[model samples]
Target: MKYVDEFRDRDKAAILVREIGALAACIGRQIHIMEVCGGHTHSIFRYGVEGMLPSRIELVHGPGCPVCVLPIGRVDACLGIAEQPGVIFTTFGDAMRVPGSRKSLMQAKAEGADIRMVYSPLDALAIARANPEREVVFFGLGFETTMPSTALTILQADREDIANFSVFCNHITIVPTIRAILESPDLELDGFLGPGHVSMVIGTAPYEFIARFHRKPMVIAGFEPLDILQSIWMVLKQIKDGRAEIENQYARVVPEAGNAAALRAVAQVYELREFFEWRGLGSIEHSGVQLRAEYARFDAERKFAIPNISIADPAACQCGEVLKGLIKPWQCRLFGSACTPETPLGALMVSSEGACAAYHQYGGKVQRAETA
Candidate 1:
């Protein structure tokens, strides 16, 4: 609570807000700063950060939710693997609700598939340990923050000679996705609130491209309200000074060089795929990772005969444009009326970290006030 209580201090928040307001006035025009993590998106909405900022400042949501960006094809693939006769499919609880082409994992489980919710890949490994005859496949997903645990789990599986355990790797890299967003012809981003958890593992070095090549200021930000306010102030300062560089506002957790052990584990277990499909963003080169040949024995793709196929997103869902900051979640016609969390029509409404779900759950009143 030492880190958390201090970050949530009201006096510190007020000071940061005042400083941010002054910076906003100095800019004197619209400035869009993206928080490239779904956790940040949820925090922003939950803390009413959108309402706190000046009208000229817009906090655009990025495609940082691993579950939101996971393509329907991949979900279908996961479902395919889950439905196998002898397999026990394990995945994070959030992923159970994500709809594939036809149904969700939860739905599949309700219909008699051997689906399970696991907190970690190690939990899936434990399941494999308990069930020797049943094949246990863990659905892997997320950025660098979660990749180390999966890598270490695979290593553990190998060490114990857990022949029945495997992983369905859907892990993605943040840098390439950010690059894709920056390269978009319609982009109007002035700066970025970098992903803190991912930065903790990969370090600040990978984000240099945003500053050096794309000429955008980036601050690796923590998930606290005051931390967000301070990060926004930092980005504004960079823009005012006409400097573009990567800064770490969450220095307490994220180091400049990152964690060497995590990086080594990731490098040992996984290799970047040439291209991977995102639900909204399409296929971006080198955006996803897969198990290395050395770990092929524990690779779920090799272990299961899944229906490897692509499934297009629902035509009515504007998740792609929403992800690109072209529109807010409410702007989509299907937002609250058709795509409530109870029955998500888009990927964004399904996950707690998702922008649509965040706005729906916490930012609805703020959004209404803005419209009024």
Candidate 2:
């Protein structure tokens, strides 16, 4: 309760809001601040922060949810691996629900594909140890926070000489994607609420580019109401003062240098791919990681000749726009009508941190009325 209660104090929150309001009046322009963490998106919606803010201060969602940004082709590739003879697929719970071209991993499991939900990569390794006869493929997907754990698991597997365990790496970097977003001609963001979890791994230095080059103010914040409010206030203050910089609001957990051991572990097993496709951003150069040549034996893609096929997204699904901050979730015609969490039209609906699902769960009625 020490950190939790202190950050959420109503008085502090009110002060931040008052400051933000004053800052907004001075700026006198539509200040678009995008929060690049899906966790932040959920927190923002859950706390009704959007409604509390000045109308001119808009918070746009970015490609923070790894599960949400996983291209449809990649999902299909996982499904294909799951269907292989004597193969057991392991992935985090979020991936189990994200729809592929035609079927989800959950549906595939229901239809007897031997897909197992794992809390961590170590859990998948344990499953592989238990079933020596079957090949265990850990479908790895996440940004920096989870990648270190997966990298460690791979190292452990190699040390144990686990022949059957392999990884399908889809680990993405946060900095490059942020650079891509800023470089894009379409997105006109005033500032960014950087990902706190990612900052814990890569540190605040990676985000200095946003401030130095793009001249956008950014605050790496934790996933709490007051943490978010304080971050919003920091961004507003920067804008008001006609200054741009990267600030760390969640300093208790994130150091400027970040977790060196975790980053070293990532470097040990993986190397950046030339390009990897994202749901919204398409193929951004060196945004994804693949197992290094030394660890090639543990790489699932190398172990199995899985066809890399490119599939088109549903013509009507506006997930691309949602990820790029071009449109809100409710702006998509399929949002509540055709794409609820129960029957998600795209990955955004399936992921808990996904902007569409967060908006639907927390701001559906309010969004509907406003849109109507």
* Segments of candidate 1 deviating more than 4 angstroms: none
Q: What is candidate 2's CA lDDT for residue 117?
A: 87
Regions of model 2 farther than 4 Å from truth: none
| Number of backbone-clashing residue pairs for each candidate, in the order shown | 0, 0
Local distance difference test, each candidate: 0.91, 0.89
TM-score of each: 0.97, 0.96
lDDT of 2 by residue, 218-259 (tens): 999999999999899899999998899999999989999999
Looking at candidate 1, what is the lDDT of residue 74? 89
TM-score result, candidate 2 = 0.96
Writing each residue's lDDT as its tens digit, candidate 1 over 242-302 gives 9999999999999999999999999999999999998878899999999999999999888
Clashing residue pairs in candidate 2, if any?
none
Output the worst ten-in-a-row residue range by lDDT, candidate 1: 363-372
Among these predictions, the greatest lDDT belongs to 1
